[model samples]
Target: MSSEPTHQNIHTFDQATALQPAGPHHWKGQPGRLYWNMVGPFGGTTAATLLHAVLLHPERIGEPAALTVNYAAPLADLPFVLEARPLRTNRSSQHWLLLMTQVDTEGQTITVASGTAVTALRRGTWAGSELPHPPVTPAENLSPRPPTAGLAWSERYDLRLLDGDLPTAWDGAHADDSLTRLWIQDLPPRPIDFLSLAAMSDMFYPRIWRRRALRTPAGTVSMTVYFHADQAALAAAGSGPLLGEARGQEYRHGFFDQRAQLWSADGTIMTTTHQLVYFRD
Candidate 1:
């Protein structure tokens, strides 16, 4: 961890909602507030922060094509260090490795997360999406989802649940299917960017919680995302809500796999993501 002191720039509350850059290859996570989850900081924000570290790096090239983040351990509420390095660079693509660690007062560094991201330059090529957009209530037609009592992170996004029930331990009717479709955007409306979209990819609740009627302890172990669009695409999206769908594929040995897709207002595929989660019954 770089001993560089924290930078003095004061980011807007919304912009720095997840992380603030302290120096080169380093950042300070936001303090306790709406960003908090039941345990530590939300995985979405942590993922975005890792990507953000890459985005801010001067040595980065092209745009993000893929990202995979492994949650090695839970993070504390204190400031943490983010380190990003370009592992390899090809003619049209670049590969990066990232690590987020927390240093104790005694100067012991504990890694909280590690990730890999691929950025590549894209040329005009034939492209198409085989999957049709899932039919669901339009953002304008649905009511705003109310935030849960203790989950302050829920308030950060305006989520309109169009299908599949939210995971509640006592709700048996929706336990069998872990599917969910919603229109989501950051609260108060912030421009769509790689940082925001990374967080949005993880906006869905854990699959185990949605599939089982009982709420057992659950969290993501690793998450991966592939960006289908570039910066211009995200910029065009502005702060508009994007349609999101997520579901579980399998469950065994206290772990399950979940995958999700994000679509723009015009049905353009923006991103696809997958994750493995751990749960205790």
Candidate 2:
């Protein structure tokens, strides 16, 4: 038999975001070109990698409840160090601090990204969702979104746009609002998990691209994802497409904020994300 890796069915997302243990609280990883963006690896993969480090921690408790990632600088395509530490662990919750750093060409190690995460032992309680799922055509009825030509990261997910696509004109005319609704899932159909959910949270394209119709430079500075569903809920979601909705709240002074929510076909809100983005004028 030919000598190939045993796990041939491993999905590309998992391989791209994989990390290896280096020390008690450190891991080593390198960026993969499959998720490369205009500048560096996709921010979603970065966030997922950071969270995955915590999940792989031996002392980890419960499931992810919240995660906030701040991109400090454009990550270079190089081997990097990941440090994850549990700051506090109580009876019901745990807090963590994470940092990713890489050595620059000048031989100085600098931070590229940092984040804070919370995992908790979920307890049953009375709950209700005030924001009902948006009414839209089912995923089966819509055609798959055409692949974005140059961005490799966009190809990782199968997207079916329902509304609010990129502007047809580039004349700097601003739309009245920035809103996009789409169905999204891993292209090769990986099982739904916290790590995958974390990545999917940052899947939307910059809202400014659709709002102003201008191809201005834009990047996420900070992003936060709040998990509304526990492990069982996520498992139930399987590998099916999730309905994702994103809209911009405000844009001012070269910065804008976006809010997005992802829901299961059955109407369970899996996660909600908010992010602050930097853009060029």
TM-score of each: 0.89, 0.96
| Clashes per candidate (backbone, < 3 Å) | 0, 0
TM-score of 1: 0.89
Clash pairs, model 2 backbone: none
Query: The CA-based lDDT of model 2 is what?
Result: 0.89
Tens-digit per-residue lDDT, 66-182, candidate 2 = 999999998887999999999999998999999999999999999999999999999999999976998899988888877778988887788889998777788888888888999
lDDT of 1 by residue, 133-174 (tens): 877667988888888889868767788888875754466544
Candidate 1 off by > 4 Å: 1-32, 104-107, 167-174
CA lDDT scores, all candidates in order = 0.80, 0.89
**lDDT for model 1:** 0.80
